[model samples]
Target: MVLISLGPLAGDVHLLNRACKGAGTHEDLLTEILIGRSNEEMFLLKEQYRRTHNKDLVQVVRGELSMKTERMFVMALTGTRDESTFVNHQQVQQDVETLYRAGPGKIGTDEIAICGILLQRSDAHLAAIAQAFPQRHRVSLTHMIESEFSGHMKDALLHVSRGAEQDGQGVYRDTQLLEAAMAGMGTKDERLCYRISRYHWNRPRFGAIKNQYQQLYRRSLRQRVEGETSGKYEKALVGIIEQN
Candidate 1:
């Protein structure tokens, strides 16, 4: 079912397993895994190695790799841990710092690649990422994007960052979401209406991100989309946000 046999992971797995059997140092397996393909599958391999060999996979990974290779493996494996918001936050902080150093102009597919790894994490972790970016970069990640990124990539980053907020549940609730939306709008009745709508949307348990917009917002997230957007343009933007 999985294409593992054909990817960078193939030989890497055998090497890792051999190393886990005490035939090689932890560093050896770490090197192989760092260069391996398939993050999700690699996570499983690390778990398997630990189970079979009684080694801390991440510890080995840290000892063997450095720089971008190290960062990449760490992000991939740490994200796989899933429940540790602490790890997610730490990785995000590091990545945001890395991105800031690279500056807006240097951002590339790797930025999106690492972001893809991060999105697998819970919304709480992702939201913290959004918060961390501005703090670290001394600029809103959104503003940075507005300056350098455009079209789908920009849209994707915004969606990912937006989802970082409270697993994105807050974005749907009319009361909670609208309040967030209208926080600085300086309008009372509109804010009140959004507030009234949110309580009914429920604060948790959106089946998917879009459901939050559809049920909680009382309009598809697209239909309600504002800001330099309207009509089908809003729909397309909302659609992107919903998907990410």
Candidate 2:
């Protein structure tokens, strides 16, 4: 694969189209791109998806997923998440209570209640919620999602929590995704390409992602790439990540 780019936003629309167009949905691709995006970025992605495919990204994603997972994406697609950095501690406490009652407070999880608060809140709000959740419930939001949900919804919610905890720059989330692309076995070239291109358009974020990867894994991203890949491919990945 060439790891082509029309920039991150454009490439995202294309990757999403490809994820949804075929018989099999690339759920991981769909989840990471859809979740954790800023409201403006989400708006542009939906607009671009509509322009490129003449299809609403929401409906397209809804068609691919079912039940709670579908609703999660639908809620995010509204592009209504509060973007303000102001964290109303009162509202954060309220959200924390709602989340606990929705999941741990009751026998069956109230999926909508959980999704609404997480998906619709700002990162500052989410950061407060994350801080308060464990303080109140004694378990992290990540663990709660793992216990209360399954499959794609779980993954998506975990993405939301981790992104929030990282202050919503998504450095940790991107670091995990980037490493996931290169982990376990043969490299996932297409995903690796898409992920690199996604951030390469923003040098600062790309560099932050590399730094975060090193912080988490104790090795530079370039070293890991060299271990897993070779020749021109390795050179390209190393070059992209090693940019000063």
Candidate 3:
């Protein structure tokens, strides 16, 4: 499974356990569970994870992942993301400069520094930073992240970046994730199911994201699913897409 929204702490715990229990972690699933969570949400998740799994979520993460990816999850597990809608332009500029130095301006990528800024900023503040970064560096922050990072770390950072909204629309990231599940030759059934299920919890917003998905790809998300999946799976995925 790829993701879930807040609440139903048990679902989050189940997904986290599934991601971390085996030999190799499920990076995409791990990214979705940990990214975009509020401090309170993360607190509930950590508590639930311990009750359900009898292991500290952070400790399990430390044991499962290594290097920059591990550091990124650890910072996210701190449950300290600034959640205010307030944007600080000065700080955004500073972060932009820091990212520039950490990425394109440096000889080698400073992965942790980049992780710190992405992990700490509020969504509103991060959206501001994303805008300022492109203006200062002549490349979009998403593009820069793609250039400088790879693997799970890159995916997590991209999740953080796109989670920030532009012009008050918050569906872009979700829309992108939905398409990613069905993109390429074969469909990612579990990811597709989890993503649609996650969004289906909020009908109105899910409706908006689905409409945006159609606008972006010039084909209906439902139509895309119809083409990629068949049998009960096709009907089920299409039903959810159509429900939106």
Ten residues in sequence with the least summed lDDT for candidate 2: 1-10
Q: Where in model 1 is the C-alpha error above 4 Å?
A: 1-83, 87-89, 102-111, 165-244
In terms of lDDT, the poorest run of 10 residues in model 3 is 1-10
| TM-score of every prediction relative to native | 0.36, 0.93, 0.89
- Off-target runs (Cα >4 Å) in candidate 3 are 1-7, 165-170, 242-244
The residue-by-residue lDDT of candidate 1 on 147-217, one tens digit each, is 65554344444444444544433343222444354345443433233222322233243234346556564
Where does candidate 2 clash, by residue pair?
A: none
lDDT of 2 by residue, 1-244 (tens): 3435366677788888888876988988888788867888888999988998898888889899898888889988888889898879999888999999999899999999999998888887888888888999899988899999988888889888887665456788889988988988689988887787777778887878888888999998888889988889888877877767
Best by lDDT: 2
TM-score of 2: 0.93
Per-model clash counts, in order, read 6, 0, 0
Q: Report the lDDT of model 1 for residue 122.
A: 53
Q: Write the per-residue lDDT of candidate 3 for residues 1-244, one digit (tens) a residue.
A: 2243344577778878888876888988899888878899899999988887788999999999998788889999999988888787888899999999999999999999999888887878888887888789899888999999998899898888777645333588889888888888788888888778767767898888878988899988888888888998788777766762
Per-residue lDDT for 171 in model 1?
A: 46
Q: If the candidates were sorted by their lDDT against the true structure, best first, what order would they fall in?
A: 2, 3, 1
Q: Model 2, residue 29: what's the lDDT?
A: 84
